[model samples]
Target: MYGHGYTQPVKPPPPAGLLVLLRVLFLGIAVFSIGFMAWAPLLRLAIVTRKSLDWGLFVAAMAADVLSIVLLGSEPGEDVRTAGGYLGITLLLGTLAVGSVYYLAADIRHFHQLRYPAYPVGQPRAAAYGYPQAPTPVPAPYTAPNPRQTPPPMPRTPAPQPPANTPPPRPPQRPAPARIDQVRAELDELSDYLRKHDEGGR
Candidate 1:
């Protein structure tokens, strides 16, 4: 989007019939200054008849006018009176050339504006040139996916078991010591064997 500061070149209105007539008069003077050059006369004729000037003819005419000026200015030395007359003629031709150039430039600008006018910023340019305005494209609306088209569900993970539900580990057991009764029984047997030996000796 362009800001309010943006501006378009406003085309000047077309020249009226009187203005066109004046242009023709100036163009004729230019053509005369160029010694009635062929292309200049043809271009002038086209203008008078309300026809577009041919690009080739326009170029040729301008070239001929420039050549004419160069040739006239490059003449050999002459008397003071002749030089004065040449200077006056040169000035007149120069004026005519300037006028003709301005007139052609205006005409070309007008034609271009007619064919392709500048519209204001943010405005439709095709409308200015008498073309139909094109429709603005709209994006399509979004929609939710159908249940039948949905993807399969992912596999579920198992939950971890709580510590309280697990069994406790048992403590390590030590080996049992010898019994006192067994020790006493061994001592009694030894005493009995000694007594029987003593009796046998007596």
Candidate 2:
């Protein structure tokens, strides 16, 4: 009994050094394009007259494509057929590899359109921290309370004189006063001295 194993055709690895060489060639082609316009007038002519060059390249590429198709269908056991298929696949892969540059260019163009424009140069940006400062509020003018209206005074409770039998209230202790004559004389002397000094200054 045979175990179930999926039978999908395994694609062969790209021909030896084929992919690498094609990449180098494409890079050279791009470099040539830049130089054509910048350094070499003759190279620029080839690029400027690209319509004819494109058609020529397209025809060659298409021929390579047809060859590839024939090779893919051919029997590998037949030497000629196997060789043709290998050559076709090689050419087809190279053509696609070259065309990828155009795809990349178109992608760049599409991305450019999607991009947002830059903010105006030299214009200052708002701060990312605090909000804009608010204007100061002016204080209201002061108004005096109405003089005519007055609050009624609170009722005072008079203390009843203690019953005569109750012990007489002890008087609060008071410290002896400074000499009245001395204090009065000191005040008079200070006032007179100040007055004389003020008059002399004037």
Candidate 3:
């Protein structure tokens, strides 16, 4: 009636092959890390993956932008300045500007991925339950009374206009207010009947 108690949908379990593939990948990375200068992240996911992932993307973006600006402001090298009246310099600046834009876009995308990675790559949970992924909040409202039930009766004249002439038509008395207890009972009965009917129809 209100809401079926809400639950977060979970992804399905991955195949056995996926687990083996991951294990092999980690083993390779560990061997490579040992061959290299003992990078902790490569050796163990615990070092790479934090309680909160920080890719330093924003800092990288800012550094790219600032470095581009600095290069432009500095004195140009003799070789670059002489190439077709600074055409080479122009291309250099353009490349830096484009790279800066790329970094900025990447940082923004990373921010969104951090906040709302609803279906992340490989679709694995923190527990490493590898799985592939991907709401209908629909409740109907009552419009009219159920067609199967008889409608409640309308108000009628109190006593069939008894002794009309003697009472001089009684000044056309006001309609009586509906009785709460009676209306409530009728509603309860109607609800129960309609519920049962709906269940049967289903």
lDDT of 1 by residue, 125-190 (tens): 444433577754555678988988969899999897669967877788654456566777889998
| Model 1 CA deviation exceeding 4 Å by range | 1-29, 33-83, 120-202
Clashing pairs in 1: none
Candidate 2 structure quality by residue, lDDT tens digits, 96-143: 565445534533343343443344544555443446744445557888
Residues 82-143 of candidate 3 have per-residue lDDT tens digits of 43435433533443344334433443454445545675434444442354433223456768
Question: Top lDDT: which candidate number?
Answer: 1
lDDT of each: 0.59, 0.54, 0.46
TM-score of 1: 0.26
> How does model 3 fare in lDDT?
0.46
Once fitted onto the true fold, the runs of candidate 2 whose alpha carbons sit more than 4 angstroms away are 1-50, 76-81, 102-202
Candidate 1: lDDT over CA atoms? Answer: 0.59
